[model samples]
Target: MASSQPNMERFLREWRQDALNKAQYESAIFIGDKLLAMTNDDNDAFFLAQVHFAAGNYTRAQALLAKQDLLTSNPSCRYLAAHCLIKQNNFVEALAILGEHTPTHLFATNAKRKTTRGVRAATARANSKTSSRHHDQGDDIPEEDILNRRYEASMCYLRGLCYAKQNAFDRAKEAYKDALRIDVQCFEAFSQLVKNSLMSPDEEDEFMQSLAFNSIRAPGDDPDMEDEPADYVQMLYQTQLSKYHNPQAFNTAIESLSTHYGLENNADILLAKADLLYTQCRFKDALAITESILMDDKYNFAVYPIHLACLYELRKTNVLFLIAHELADTHPDEPCTWLAVGVYYFTTGKIADARRYFSKASMMDANFGPAWIGFAHTFAAEGEHDQAVTAYSTAARLFTGTHLPQVFLGMQNHAMNNMTAAEEFLKTAYSLCKTDPLLLNEMGIVLYHQDRLKEAVKMFASALKIAAETDSDPHAWLGARTNLGHALRRLRKYDEALEEFDQVLRDGGKDAQIFCAKGLIYLDKERPEEAVQVLHEALAIHPQDPIATELLNKALEESAEAGDIGLLGTADAAFGGETSEEGGMSGDLASFEQRLGEKKFAARMKLARGRRTAAEMPGQSGGVKDKGKGVARSGRRGAVGGTRLFRGDQEGVDSMELSD
Candidate 1:
């Protein structure tokens, strides 16, 4: 009989790639089913179970593997069954399955190996077939030793994963180390270590570099294989870990992997690349890549949020709404899907709709930070400042690892005119995330308001430096430049201030605010002609801006005074006793305080200086008389009409008088 062994081996090889190629995967599934029917053996059953597990059909795989007899079936099949159980989140059952198979000498060699008289079996079966291949061969190594080692490594790796799932980090680390001791090339354990932040950046870089120089086989060994290819996900995960700490190394590593595997054909790798691009603010490129992925699989939830973000940044409002709706339909219960839709609504000024969607997301997952932030934004837009602060605080507490909540809190305070509070929050945020340019710019604004000109200049300079580094993000760079110009102008650095303003104008040539700042500097320097020109340009861009108009009037007055100026020989009008209310930054707060005091004075006089009157009644028999010289005369008391009178009598008469 022609055995189906070779075809089965090929099936396992292609199946293990897990490339997510529809045609290849379907083909492998068909071939595996055919092999299972033809052979109906333990190896065939195990292969089919693996095929199911790799395709994310964990329940079906677990059922088939549980049908095997524990005493005679291969131990690897039991281990794989445990893995499937873990994938299904049945950790207790998985641990039980793992307990049934120990990597002992008796267990490895006695269960499946044919025995003849126990001791006189000098020669093994001529060509005994096994489940898979192994590349490691040395005269000094015994076959049983290799088998036991592989079993031990596999056992420890799974145990570590279980502990990690249970959040037992220390125990997980020990278990991973045990796996590494048995099999030095266990990439899964190493990847987990890096993910858990147990390894430093240098150690991770060294580990990745070592992979290129060493001949490391993957966890499983194929006996017919001459060389094993690098696992695709492992390479991609490593690249992700390296991207933030060492971007150059990340690029180099990815380029090397692409040369070998051609990552363009893989969706997962494409997503990773797009994520890296997004982080670097190459939004347009990221959008293109993400859209391509969607073409193949529109239901890929992992890429949907990123695609939504790219569309929002590009101002593709219609496309953004269409995709957001599609995502909601695809994943109705997903918190991220709702968050994406809510953020889209928030961006387009549909605040009530945004709040409704954000509340839905928060209800779905109470711990979701972005949804809570969206809730805060809705409250802020509605002028409910206190509610906004509360929601933002909750998000900040829930997501302590990120700086976004604090940054937004600071911005909210700034908008409410709470400068000191805004500065404090921004300082804390900067301590947490030192490289954020937005925080730096806001801090500078606060300092400028406080008249800390020198320190404000430093803050703006730092923000500009950081913002300039992100060349792909033009808004950040432009905002920082404008802030720098304002700060320098305040410091009397006319030339430098003009240069900054000119740089912004050249970059866009449309910002009225930049032109306003330039005109202000020209006014300060007595360059009235130039000031008038730029101020008019600013008014043309933004008609009748208050600051621009004021500065332009001052410039025109200075020009007229310099040409045909005449000191007033006589006042055209005498000043009234009343002073005009103080205006501008120099006197606004003082004038407000004065107005507050005048209102308080009026209220106090109304309460303390009340008027009273006393009337004289000629028809009355008697009444109390006024004592003008601090002397009082008591009159006889008498009853007039069923009431006691203070000073009344039938015979004696007194007069009553009003006094002031």
Candidate 2:
């Protein structure tokens, strides 16, 4: 029956494989359980536990392991049981099983080692004091010293494990090396040392040899102990407490760990400290801790991601580049490192380089949203609007809830001079996120351009209200104010427009549009000179400005016309005084003769002249007139240079007629 068991196991394995391949997890678990019952072997039991674990039947797996008493016979079964207990948050029991059974397993061992080390240290110290008087005795001294030294070395190895678990690879490697210095034959310490050292330098052969030697020892040669130290419980409690976000709890954990184990040797405590600083937005301090880990040659690949994140948070882009370059050079197969490099490039405005790195990231993992977004932004920068839209659309489709792609799409259409389409996309974006002041402001600007003045005013007003209420952004408020001023100006509400422009100026808005609007108000008030001065000032700030140039010409022409009218008024006053000296007839006859002489000369020359000349020049009598009026008078008909200066209404005769 035992001989045929192998055949039965193979048949069951084939059946389970078929069930799994066919997406029949329930059938797979049923077959695996039967195999477990028939064989009661370590391999079959482990497989059965896996099927149950996969199928979310962790309770059944725990019961099966407990019934078989396979926890001792199989280290893997112990690990699986502990994993299930951890999932169930039976951490104390999980810690015990993990500490006792898998003393050198990376994940479970690291998880429990800090607590275990404290317990062992207290026990050793207690034993040492009890035997203190025999310390100087020859045989006993050496033996006791060796035991204490081994305990100390083991404690250091445990510290390394704690550090490794928290992603502090450098501190972990240091602790492991310290353990090895005290006890070179310490397999756990040597194993971690080899693992961490191989992370930076390619020493695969040496790492394999170290692993081979570490696993060669027997259970009896290094017997597992059960007397846990007091400090272990305290450290375990602190680790559990660190998961909460309470600052006081983190502080308590840090102080306790540092006081008991020393901060330099406590990598878990250091990681907790870094996390606390990160929560406080003290990214620089977090970056310093992460950088210390990367500098160590023994740092693990898992820690690289955390280190990258810390550098990114601090915006230490240059250092991130160097780290990424090193990671790419050594770990070319890993896509995350290359993806990080692409993100850095994209943020720094190196669009083409960003696209290349993003392409590399895409090749590694095509579904990476960030890489796709970076690729899209690069195309947008290069003015490939259609391609950019497609890339952003693809990224949005993959990650449905993100707003970044929609924002980019609106910006692209706005840049392409498609204002209507831009407004449509931005309205959808506003519906999705109404509190976004930027989207509101952009939509308002589009409406302003489309000449929907009332709608534009409402939009800008809404943006302003939201910005004020939320303290959203000062710049957004400034933009809305500027747009509001423009809309008011178009409506010819010059006073209200000036008030808005003044508000923007007070708000530190030195933009050219604000100045231009203020100039327009001056122009509307018939104060062209003032308008010219303001427009010129704007031009000085922004040379070759088109609006300023146009306004300046109108101002100069109006000034010239006003100057000519003042000169004509002075000429009339001088001629009036000279003609008043004679009697009314002589003055009028002389003026008429002067006007007639001037008219005959002008008619022969056919000269085009001012209205003043037409009114004052001599007419048919060929004499100057001093008619007691400024130039032409009541009941008088006069033509100068064949042009009639006075109509019948001006002549004061009922129907006076003039001849040329």
RMSD of each: 24.7, 29.8
Residues 290-395 of candidate 1: C-alpha lDDT, one tens digit per residue: 7999899877755654565556556677886886787788788897688678867765767789789879977895544446656776766555567877876775
Tens-digit per-residue lDDT, 426-451, candidate 2: 77656444543444555666665565
Compared to the true structure, candidate 1 yields what TM-score?
0.58
Off by over 4 Å in 2: 1-340, 343-349, 362-368, 558-660
Model 2 deviation from native, Cα RMSD in Å: 29.8
Most lDDT-accurate candidate: 1
Which candidate number would show the highest TM-score if scored against the true structure? Answer: 1
